[model samples]
Target chain A: MSEDDAVAGPTDDGQLVRVEGFLVRLDLAYEPDGHLWVAPPDGSTGNVRIGLDPLGVETTGTVAHLVVGSVGTRVRRGEPLGSLEAEKFVGPLVAPLTGVIRAVNPALATPRQVVEDPYGTWVAEVLPEAWEEESAQLVRGADRLPAWFADEVRRFRLEGVLAQ
Target chain B: MGPEALLETPARPGSRGSRRAGRTLGTLRVLDFGAVSPVRSQSLWHALACGVGRGSPAALALCRPAQPYVSLGYHRPLADLDLGTCRRRGLPVLRRLVGGGTVYLDPRQLFFQVVVPPDAVPAARSQAVAELLGPARAAFEAAGLPADFDQGELAVAGRKVCGHGAGLVGGAVVVVGNLLERFDAAAAAGVLWAPDAESRRRLAGRMAECVGPDPTWPVDAQAFAEGLVSAYAEAFGVTPEPGGLTPFEERVARRFDRLLGSPAFLCGPGGQSETQLTERRRAEIWTVKVRAGVVEARVVLDSTVLRAALVGGRLRDVVVEDPEGDQDPGVATALEGVTEGSPALEALARGGPSAARAAAAAARLLARARGGGE
Candidate 1:
């Protein structure tokens, strides 16, 4: 199928641009802020995944610890999630999609293990039964976050929190 | 007036000569309930949770714990903790409802809780969280402690005396943290179940980096809490009515009874079975290979060792391969469980996992490096 057909929106195909890198789109959802979705393109195996848009990593800085759940565990879309340890924050790991956890990176059990190899330390994998259902609520591949990420960053800046 | 002389209780409404023309924007009441025991931190947290849960504006005075402990955010992993150290030291470990990094607490510290209605201060983002730390710093000044808002942690001369974390519930912003009087640095390092010698080294290095040089002042918890209450009243422009718990607060406490007393929340949730991968897994699995330029570390794990590595970061890269096994039996023996402790994992995380392990492989390694090798 044509790339345009697979994608939900318009493309820059007119330029015939061919970027050299692998890309895997992911649909994400989380709790505390309520339900939302996003399909982020796959980055590297060890590079940090940022929440530039809403559904990305919200807090700034390298991860200090990442504890994911067991594989085959059935998770709801916006459940209590897992846990993430940043330099200054330790937050819960909410589910991005409701599905069976396919895998969790064992490397993350170590402190700052994810920061050392964020891409390599993929926290967990889930085979969502309703990827379409969840993705429909999320921002498309190239769209900005519907939620106020920039505003939140600005608030953090005003409070003297530097972005890492 | 001196910098410390800046603290003065605000005048009550309708009693001041130049009473500013204003209706109650909101009743900004502060509470100086005085010192209880170290256990009061959670009691105060519950009181604040009630106000926050119901979206009420409030603040409280708090104190640091006498014994040291490790606190995790709600839903954090027990595996992240080094249970052996906690067991050895008899230190308590608990999980908090707010979101933030793990923190160590002791008697030398002072704590404060701010429960404001949602949007009390406009941006409720990470930076905003730091802004909230402003009152805490002011409180330190009020109490005659050299404290300031430095990054996310509170510092006195580049060393952190206070660290804070916050969360919102039912439209109430609850921010909490403490000031340090004393810390058991040795015990603090002992909390992690380091997977290997190298990782332990990195952990120690990081702790030292963050801790920096210690302070020279004596920390008084009671005096500190009082000072913070005065500071909060000044910064938020409110009058603190030294008082007891309100009915709503009491109601919420009863509602959250399990939360306050549960072991799961207090000690962090127990690790899942998979989180405790066995030593066989640690021995057989091909772990991540690390090349630190100066050295290299290759680790293999079985299920048991894998679980240990999962608990902490040390052993993930601890197995050594000496091409010439006869090169040095003494050194090899020393490196046997190089990454088996907390400090080792910390060291490996900061420095190279291999280099740290190699350095600790034997007294000969240290001796040779120091020009005293056999």
Candidate 2:
């Protein structure tokens, strides 16, 4: 994707909010501390997809390699679902919600896809064990997302992750 | 405090999380283990990092390995290093719970580790890395080396003087770096899995040019350690307090030491087999970053292999070899000094099919080296 495609703002449906050139999808629930977004569960499969937000990809210099949890493996919120090795940094992929991993993304084969199109490239699909209780802890809704996302962008900028 | 006072202090049970939230301590704990076994050099700080929590004070641990070893990053594939070469040389290949590429370490280098609570540094990885390495740069400067920390690397005169790795380990942020009094470029290159002897030689030459400190400047290990401690104390605005490992940290270190050397851990998460690694070597462009802006790559094309050294995105010492035992000297000469992202393909088209193929492969290899995929 081109730089223009990456920085494209929210759609007319009012799902995304543009924060400092990064499109923050308000429709998805977020684990702000972990910089992960949780898509609403599929009605048929009842599995929620999880991915790193644009901000997370931006902070991690270059996505060298990604090791995601195997399918059927159980994980807890704040525990390592996997690990990401970037150019200068390495860290865990903290699970946003407790659940069993249903599937791992084929995008792991090309980590740059995750960097280029974060929203489109989901990291893993999880069969959330406590959607009602655990998802409540996530930051969601259009009402709260914009301001929170804007603040996050500002925080990253102040922290030198983004250009001032 | 003195060594006697530090050793006399009893280990506090469950004191890892004893500090109150948001409270900054006035002292930086200094654990200076002069020289230790390769595993202990890594495990000591790792244990401290794992034990850090909300109220935990930042600690700086300094040590050097008594023997040489190859340390791989936490998520790095074991295939990155030539395990047989390491084993034959009696060099233990250990993996550290940190992020960075594979490295060959020996007694000539002094290691400095900083373990702090997550909140102590910036949230952004790059920013945090730079902040953590600031004191190391200061220490090098105080030692009369014109050092600067740029893009998360400490360099002297454009050559990387210190190797660094950082990661969020458990409840703490850990940054580990080495003060290179000397670096064995040949040994460093030898440990890497290269497809051929020529490719390994090219890698070693590039490493010799791009990495390590200035040979002329003499570095006193004791003075450098003291400088690093003082630098950290000043940077954090805290007093240096001599301290030894708590019993809890010691136990964790022992566990880590065992984990670091285990065969399962050495294989890494993917359990990359030799067959898979061989396939990857055949199918992909093998590249290693000597330092920022300098890379060495070997690209294997059908019936031909192209090895090139890239300095600042421009090709240098380009070599093309065919399986029929023929070396394309003309193509190698013509391709020299070609910049990446340029029309190298069209330029080499006149040299025939094999040259054109080699140019295309070189371009892709260069792109991969620069972190820009083809």
On TM-score, the leading prediction is 2
lDDT digits (tens) for residues B1-374 of candidate 1: 11001101110111111122222225455654444443455555655555654545566645455556676654344554567677777766665656555455665555667766444543324543665667777666655567755555667665666667765432345677766566545455557545565555545544543452364565556666667777677766777766556787766544444453355445443245244434323533212211110112223321112111211223222334444232333333334344334354345335444334444442222222222000
| Top DockQ prediction, candidate number | 2
Q: What fraction of the real A-B contacts shows up in model 1?
A: 0.06
Candidate 1 CAPRI grade: incorrect
Output the number of the lDDT-best candidate: 2
Give the B-chain TM-score of model 2.
0.88
Query: Interface RMSD for every prediction, one decimal?
Result: 16.9, 11.3
Q: Each candidate's chain B TM-score?
A: 0.61, 0.88
DockQ of all candidate complexes: 0.10, 0.34
The lDDT of model 2 is 0.76
Local distance difference test, each candidate: 0.45, 0.76
Docking class of 2: acceptable
